[model samples]
Target: MHFIHTNKSFLLISALIMAGLILQACGASPETTPQETPLAVQTELAGTEVSIVTHSFPASAISAQEARLSTIVMGTITMLDVNEGDRVSRGQVIARINDNQIRAQLMQIQAAKMQAAAGYELAAAAFRRITNLYEQESATRHELDEATAGYNMAKAQLEMLEASEQEVQEMLAYTVIRAPFEGVVSRKFMRAGDLAAPGQPVVTLSSPGLLKIRAHLPENLIRELTAGETIRYSVPAAGIEMDSVPLTRVNSSGDQMSRQFSAEAVLPDAHESGIRPGMFATLHLSISDEPAIFVPQSALVHRGQLTGLYAVTESGQAVLRWVRTGRAHEGRVEIVSGLRSGERYISVLDTPVRQGQRVSL
Candidate 1:
């Protein structure tokens, strides 16, 4: 029984070996081996392009015509007819100071003027009477001279008082503050019942549509600016971009303290857009133009403070190399060093690319 069991085991092993040999000889199944999978990546050639190097200097929207409303007289603000953001026309009253004192003075002057008029009338009548007496030889020469001096003094006194009265009236007019032009009330520095001084502003009136982009740039940048040159600008808050807008003014002479000149560009028409004064704006001024190699920003691998991108080799391998970058325009960045022209670099890395990973173009 043991010998029979051994023969049965040997027969089973022999049958399995013969089947494997027959399958190999007949080519029923081909040999299989493992292969390395290459990763798919997108690449672009690093070449020179006409890169218009633009600089973004901070800018603000400012009203071209702005006025600070106030009165020459120092007194308590009696009436404030408008608040901030109120629309007003030219010559419209915006605020009034305490004009009671001025008005009272005007009345007192008017009374004095009337008295001076009466005195002048009396002097004129007396002069005429004295002249008739002298002509008829009934008055002495000394008496006629005395009347002439007296009449002249009276006439001068009357004129003096009348001039004082007109001066007081002009002071009364200064108590009322009015808008200088058609504009909106932007700020209120003093409220009703507040003591207002000659220089202290009561309200600020600013023309809304008359806005310009004001930028304080360095001397180097101001040299490249020119009037009537179309450029690009954007209102950051409103997300509005206006291209082809001409630069209306460029001032090379800055204030003594600032040492930075100002340049202006016309703001977009307020009627067509929601751009307003005081909104933040960014002006892209093209300071220079040169041919340079650039790559997309997405390909940059930022590790701590260093920036790097994957460069594809001719041997179908991705090698991550550190590079020095320069000014960036839109989504592309300038490669200043570490990458040469005509070299292939990854522009868009949607996968987790490594330092020495194999990649397929």
Candidate 2:
């Protein structure tokens, strides 16, 4: 009990015990040999695959037959029978302008025509009387001449009035607007009661069934396209792709200002697929088909401004090799340079690694 109560003795005993533990740890050896397992990773051989390089240009779907429905006669729009998106047949009445003034003018012409006809009839009777009298030697030559001149003048006047009447009637026909072809109304600019003038459009009608793709190709690539050749196109918004669309037209004579030429392709199934005019489209012109090497995008490492990928050496070590990359497609990037065909490169990694680390396939 006295030995246990002494504080200096307890501290001295604790220090001696710690010193013995340290010495024993120093003298002991590992029971089983300590070993390092190689880091497991997957590897693949780099090789050339067929790569499709294309020059794509933005395009639009347009109606092959489009028209702006307008009236030649100026008047107030009295009737607009169709709205936007309304389907119309060829020669269908679309809109009408108030032709009350035209009708009034026509009535005035008709009255003048009647008066001229009455005068012509009277002149004809007088000329016939003069002819009979002159044949029977009962009239003077001067009187007959005067009667003949009056008949000719009256006949001319009557014919002139008839022409005027016809002119007014034709102008009346121009007040009614009609569709030139079967199509849908894309826009209605002048509604009912709106003032309409000549050359101003009342509605925009397009032949939706005759839809085609129109694109402006740059001058550099215009030589590669030709008429009657089938090309591939896509409507990204509609998720539609066409591979065998027949090219209807291509103009290599590039525009002077824009330095581009126009191209058009027939869309045979555009109506069925709900592709309408003014919808966006893309035209794909295949540039080349050659073997190009590609690397997995996941394996690319970016250290500041430099990009590198891990490659395996013959001695089974990971060496970080800097690579110049091109465009990325799908899940892989194009190896423009710094990598060769049939070379070994690291793929997806499970654990982070460093340069000179051992990798086992």
Candidate 3:
């Protein structure tokens, strides 16, 4: 009976083992099963509207007119009427030097001028009287000639004194510096009590009406620029951005050292927008017109040392494409090469993607 019991147990254990193997082969646990992600749907992508002909180059800002203010005469500065950033009109008094000595000299000149006038009058009368006497034969010829000569000498002395007085008056005027034009004062080099010397700058002013941007261009590119050609410019410091009016002047000649041509563009007053002289600016020169593929900046992806885009294929698969980029503007980047028009691209993907990986639009 015991042997019979052992045989039944063996049969039961064998049957249990076979049943377990069958179940394992027929079913899989959640952890062992491969997960399948939902396939992404393909959709039509909107075409990006980009400029057909665009060129970008390095640029710089320069003043259209710059003037250095200087004192015309040497004197101790007594008063300064304008400070830096002060607006001044043409012929407005900007500053004054201590002209007490000058004024005293002017007064002496004026007194001398009066004395000269009196002497001239006396000489004229004496000459007239001597001529009458000679005509009446009441005076000898030698006496009349001596009187005439004396009168002429007095007249010459008076003329010389008058000229000297006028010169002194002009010199006095130079003690008070005046604005040469209507402009804003950009600098103040001298203050009250400071000694001002001739040809030394005391202030700097620039015209408020005239403005331009100056930049140096490569010698090879100089031939492409011409007067009256419009370009784009930006001034970040002044928050100015506008399509610059045509270049009013172009120095076609290149610099001997840098071999760069000097160019200038005139800016309209309407576009000034608080831009001041010496503000930084940039210029975008137009070289040629050509068709190019472009993409929005949002679609770009950087991986290591490469820049590319995740392009969706017709089969709804993400294809990472390496691309060559060019000038960028207004959130759009130029695809110089490695891209074509009418191709759909993924601007924003939902999750991490790989090459040839299935994706949805």
Candidate 4:
């Protein structure tokens, strides 16, 4: 009975060793196999509606005509009738200079004229007497000739004095500076007690009705804008609003330094709205027309120097497409390439997505 029990115990031990070998052959170690990773899912997004459009280079506002007022005659400025930003009319007095010297000279010329007139009268009386004497044969022919020469010289002297007086009067008028045209005085260059000289500026004025914008544009853009074409302008600082003003002129020649052509646009009643001369402005111009696709700025994704969008393929695959972009407006960006209209894009996606990976919509 003891020998039978020992054989049974050996058989049990052998069976247990065989079972352990089978478990190792099956590769059941926990360290060998990794845990399963979660798959990323992408959501379908409706593409933004885009419109075909054109764009152009921006422009700045400039003065169409700026005149610097100067004195035509030299004298001390005694009175200034207008201040800066004061409206003036044509022929209105803007300033006055001291005219005491000119007035005194005019008076002196008047006195000389009076003396010459008396001399002329006396000469005429003497000539008439000489004529009577010659007619009666009481005067020699030489004497009559002498009397005629004296009379003519006296008359010439009177005429010279009269011319001198007129000249003095005209010079005196120059002391009063008058507005050349109806405009607002944009600047005051001189003050009372200041000496004004010929060609020296006293005030600078601008015509409100003739207001316009001047800009320099690149040569390539010159062909895009033309005379009579309308453009828009705005002044945020001055709170002025304008639109569709006709372009008045364009210089075909480009600037030597900037290689840009000069352009101008006429503003309609800009002065009435307090749009002062020399105010800065912006100009918009259309340059060209080209076809392109666009998307909202919100749909863009950034990945370290790569700007792209999440796209969902027709077969429900996640794709990260790189794209080129153009101008942006109202939160929409132009997709110059790499996108098409009416295509489905993935705006939102589950984290850890990869390209060509199947994703649940």
- Best by lDDT, which number? 2
What is the C-alpha lDDT profile of model 3 across 1-361, one tens digit per residue? Answer: 9999999999999999999999997896656777557456333354545364455555555446668877678999888878888989999988887888888888887888788788778878988898999999998899888888878888888888888878878888888888888888978898988999999988988776677887887787777778887778888777776566788888967889988787788777823576667777787885654455667777788888899987787877778889989877667788876667778887654456677877656
Task: Tell me model 3's lDDT, rounded to 2 decimals.
Answer: 0.77
Q: Order the candidates by TM-score, highest first.
A: 1, 2, 3, 4
> What lDDT, from 0 to 1, does candidate 2 have?
0.88
Query: Residue 145 in model 2: shift from native, Å?
Result: 2.8
User: Taking the tens digit of each residue's C-alpha lDDT, what string does model 2 give over 63-88?
Assistant: 99899888888999998979899999
**Model 3, runs deviating above 4 Å:** 1-66, 218-224, 252-261, 270-272, 288-361
Q: Lowest-scoring 10 consecutive residues by lDDT in candidate 1?
A: 266-275
- The TM-score, computed over Cα atoms with residue i paired to residue i, of candidate 3 is 0.59
Candidates' C-alpha lDDT:
0.86, 0.88, 0.77, 0.77
Return the clash pairs for model 2, or none.
Answer: none
Please report the TM-score between candidate 2 and the true structure.
Answer: 0.64
Q: Lowest-lDDT window of 10 residues in candidate 3?
A: 41-50
Per-model tally of clashing residue pairs? 0, 0, 3, 1
**Best model per TM-score:** 1
